[model samples]
Target: MIAEIIPQSSALTKKYTNFYITNLLILKNMGQVLGMISAVLILSAIYFRVGGQKNFSNGLFIVGIIGEILFIAIMIMAIFD
Candidate 1:
């Protein structure tokens, strides 16, 4: 009885582990892509402000800051889902 029960439990554990690994780890690529986009946007915003150095460039500076915040939020969210 002991020998028979051990094999069945081990088989069940293996099946569940495989299912989680196969289905759950595939979406990390999207997070990487989003992170890249976020970085680019922030950099561009900074570039715009630095190049101009005028009152008119304030909007660009704000955009860059917002982009950075959004990037951080996305990175945090990606870990759980």
Candidate 2:
């Protein structure tokens, strides 16, 4: 009975561990991509502002802020996961 139970529990643990690791990896990648996108958006916004495109710059800045927030959230989740 002990031997049978041990193997079953170990198998379940391994399965869950793999799933957890996979999720963490996905979150990490998403965070990295969001960070890059946010950086580009912010830079583009700055460029637009300098070029006298106030409306476009403001829109880009808002989107960039949202992306940055998402990136931070994902990174926090990955860290605590």
- Tens digits of per-residue lDDT, candidate 1, 60-79, equal 55665675676566556545
Candidate achieving the largest TM-score: 2
Best by lDDT: 2
Tens digits of per-residue lDDT for model 2, 22-63: 878888998999999999999999999999999999999999
Off by over 4 Å in 2: 1-9
> Per-model C-alpha lDDT, please?
0.59, 0.86
Cα deviation of 28 in candidate 2 (Å)?
A: 0.8
Candidate 2 achieves a global lDDT of 0.86
